[model samples]
Target: MNVNIITIDGPSGSGKGTLAARLAAHYQYHLLDSGAIYRLLGLSLSEHGLLEQLNDDIAKCVAIAEQLPIVFKSTEQGVVVLLNGIDVSAKIRTEEVGEYASKVAAIPELREAVLQRQRDFAQAPGLIADGRDMATIVFPEAQVKIYLTASAESRAARRVKQLQGMGLDVRISDILANIQARDKRDMERTVAPLKPAEDAYFIDSSDIGIDEVFNLMTSHIDAKLANN
Candidate 1:
């Protein structure tokens, strides 16, 4: 069997990013982190001091996505996202950047610009893609599509802890509300709203360890290969 494409799609904080990187390492595959593209757009806008005018210059956002110089920097901890020659892994992690990413990602032109860039990462051995729309839009024909998700509360709690781990103090209640609001916005948006692809395999990681989630995903990958 030579199945070589794996897509992990989900909302933020569902452990999909960690699982996707693990799967890439396990299969020696190229990894495409699509969310980073949106983050890059947000960071690029911020760099120009034009973050406040993003809504007025939607075309500029698409242009940036159409030509993003974002790259993955391997660090001891995990992948650090770099934009336009600057290591902005920390700046992009803030709640403000996340919110801007959500809005920028909703633009139809921006999505189109980044679509092929995401697909071009797929290669011979395999490709593990992590993003909200990977299975649905970017790689609908992926051999194995995993929609990893968790309860809203669980996701928010994990995000809060993650922020605190980075030395940022935040309100758990605010994070929870933000998560719920994002869920609604992402699902109800006019463009490619976030939802599990029709043929995607769903997994809830509300109470599982990251390694355990990886095992479950790889077990399904093995089965998918057998089917292929």
Candidate 2:
């Protein structure tokens, strides 16, 4: 049997993370959240007070990215991010860490350093990879490539709801602005800019529910698999 790999590439708040996990479970495949890997590196650098040294010392940044003590643990809730044996799932999801992750990821050498580590997750039964460049740059040969997207306003509203559920007070306006700013940075970044693969099936989930999106994706994947 051929190795089945599904790549979901999108910007933050595009629902790629949730979609990837669901697809992984539905197919019993391994999951890779490439952003989390960079987030772990960002968090580690922040803890070491080296985030500011990224552009200044590219060599140091590459060195740090080379030895990331990160692991992904699947659970009833979702995939949990572990750093050095400690659960840091919640810690890496903050806007601060996301910004850091984007900045650090822009360094070409740093991305190259962790490229193989990300590729290593593709194995056995299958793999569902999710991130900004999963389809275009990381898993170009994936059997199924999806580019999930949403309007900035819609994405910000979803993010606001998530933060409110955590009892955090956040303004929708602020969240929307942040989303737009992050979009600009991610798309303009020289290395691994956010974009859909030419062959990717694009889904704009601005007004759709997760289940509907999942159904659409599974339909696409099933058709692709049958043809393959």
Candidate 3:
């Protein structure tokens, strides 16, 4: 059976995750935060004391990806991720874990190992996948492809607000630098680099609000579903 899918791809802090989650609820579809998968893997590696050897021991990383003991539970608040039966929903969202995730994501072998696991999230109703390569790689055949982005400065400012809201002290300059660096790494990586799919609808949220972005995305999705 063919399942309808909507892919939202963009850089970190561009609000793709928030947008994807809202769309998933609106459509009552399964939500796949592909970045979270990598973060979980990164967290796992860190727990195993293998994070430092990512470059020296990629084989170990791939092996862990192939047998990731993770689970996603939906709650009114949001999805709760469990790693090895332990709740790590908050643990994997740290900036450090995000950096680790970015590094691991650049490894082609690790991405390949987790590819099928991501695809399995597609179910009968449909799915909304959020990630850097969702449109270009993971869900290339998705009915609606969206490349949502914002200026680096804008994204950094937003991230600062988020981190501050979480009671974490963060500097905008530091956050800006990290965002820029990650964008470079994600866009220049040789394998599955972050880029808009040829047929994707691009939306720059730099000057727009989340509600506006959501409306823009849903309009595209509605049109696509009507035609489908």
lDDT of each: 0.83, 0.91, 0.92
Q: Estimated TM-score per prediction?
A: 0.93, 0.97, 0.97
List residue ranges in candidate 2 displaced over 4 A.
none
**Cα lDDT tens digits for candidate 2, 1-228:** 557999998889989999999999999999999989989998988888889888787787788789878888889998888899999999899878988898888888888999999999999899999998888888898999999999999999999999999889999999999899989999999988998899999999999999999999999999999998
Error of 2 at 163 (Å): 0.4
lDDT comparing candidate 2 with the true structure = 0.91
lDDT of 1 by residue, 133-173 (tens): 88888888899999999999999999999999988899999
The sequence of per-residue lDDT tens digits that candidate 3 reaches over residues 9-126 is 9999999988998999999999999999999999999888988888788888789999999898889998899999999998888889999999889988999999999999999799
Question: Top lDDT: which candidate number?
Answer: 3
Measured over all alpha carbons after superposition, the RMSD of each candidate to the real structure, in angstroms, is: 1.9, 1.0, 0.9
TM-score, cand. 3? 0.97
TM-score, model 2 to reference: 0.97
lDDT at 126, model 3:
96
Q: Cα deviation of 97 in candidate 1 (Å)?
A: 1.0
